[model samples]
Target: MQKIVPNIWFDGTAAEAAEHYARVLPDTSGRVLMRYPEEGLPDFQKALAGQPLTAEIVVGESAEDGGCRIVLINAGPEFAPNESISFMLNFDPSRDPDAAATLEAVWAGLGDGGEVLAELDEYPFSPRYGWIRDRYGVTWQLILTHPDGEPRPFVIPSLLFCGAAQNRAKAAIAAYTSLFDDSGVGMIVDYSTATGAVRADSVMFGDFRLAGQWFTAVDSPEPRDFSFTCGVSLQVNCADQAEIDRCWEALSAVPEAEQCGWCADEFGLSWQIVPEEMGSLMASPEAYGAMLAMKKIVIADFPK
Candidate 1:
């Protein structure tokens, strides 16, 4: 019942991704939170006539530390990677001493043909850290908080961006840390003259808080196979059109911006600028009708 359940947008695999998440996470289950059940056989047939069915699921652990729940929703259209959103993982190095190795296996399993943005390495920011995308084209950052046998948890919370110009991770962190109270960067390491930019003597790695949650970021200058995509988009609930307008303008400045509440920042991530009352409005039995209403929403007329 937590208000903020991280929401993941799928090209068309919300149910599928939720299942995988349920299996991979610590103590969690992915169950269908909602589905468009056939209203009337005729209407259902009409709805199914040429449209695809959609489903949403809540996935996470039920334990004390496992309050993480993500809602995965299927997309009505095909999805692509752009810079409007990205998924982040908060890894606990203490839970499993071999946590780093185990994470590599997860990447290897999921990232068959996906590019390796960064080979696993011991970062100054953390003991171990790296980034990779699965064959499914989803981006993931694996951070090992402690490698020297310490107590920790592995968390992979997704993030949303309004719009970033080139690569928004750094900028997003900067903007995010700016907006939230009691949130800031934990550690930042850049390529020193000694290390050089090619790799760098040290790069940023550490906790950054946004909306009171530990968020982290690093710069990836290249457009790798694993860029941001709708498979995981952050959903921002704005208070009013004025707020929506501010968010939309800032987040849609990138080249990969798209229709239907989707946009990529300069960094190739996607995000959704939704109204605060959207959840409540769309939770009713008429949600599908609302989705139908939303399907016609133009980026310019979104809110403001």
Candidate 2:
């Protein structure tokens, strides 16, 4: 089961963005998971009435297929997705014979009205790879993987620790691994000394697993204008209230960032920790109203 899911906030129409991804990426499809309430919405969200509140896009048919799920949020243009958090798509030749061709197709599709940060060409590390930001301002890194490397999922959420959060990749990964079960650090490659723009003792590339999901973290030697923000958040679905409480206590570092079950960690990354019953609980108008006023979700307070 997927315990942690990546949530992306889009300034444009989320449903359209989901569909765009489905059309571009292979073995992917988009569906509207939840719609905004037709009535009793706040003024800011009034325009989104009867529209998709949350849209989901699954990379593969199932988790057993080594795929992942992503949630696209429907909200105002308050937040913008940046390179600070991006999804890494791996096309392993061992798993698929046409990995190179498929990667090219994905790269071209994502390049539609997208800005290429790294050209799609051979690099020292990979024969074919590229980093780009799509039309919706969401970034993705597509890479053709070597068959001999350790097996991993098709999709991996990556973090670029730059700006104010530079050189904290190790600490951030440690904090997350300690909070979640079945989590541990995988491979970590750090810079030994400062090299021009590169910083000393910074993580060049590090990957870890949290709740069975693969994620990579990179400590940017060079600073950028962006860092972690609410635009890209990780949503954790808990089995019960106890799990939610435990996760909240361990991850919530900013008191002011807590709102409606959402909290920002010390690394400035946003997270939504909620019970699996969240959808059912928020079904009632009363419960929905109560959630708007909550800091940490209390399942007991929800209407039964």
Point to the candidate with the largest lDDT: 2
lDDT digits (tens) for residues 14-58 of candidate 1: 667666755655455666555553552244245443233444443
Model 2 C-alpha lDDT per residue in residues 33-122, reported as the tens digit of each score: 888888888888888888888998999755465568899998889998999999999999997899999999999999999999999999
Q: Which ten residues in a row have the lowest lDDT in candidate 1?
A: 295-304
Error of 1 at 149 (Å): 10
lDDT against the true structure, each candidate: 0.53, 0.90
Clash count per candidate: 25, 0
Model 2 Cα shift for residue 171 (angstroms): 0.6
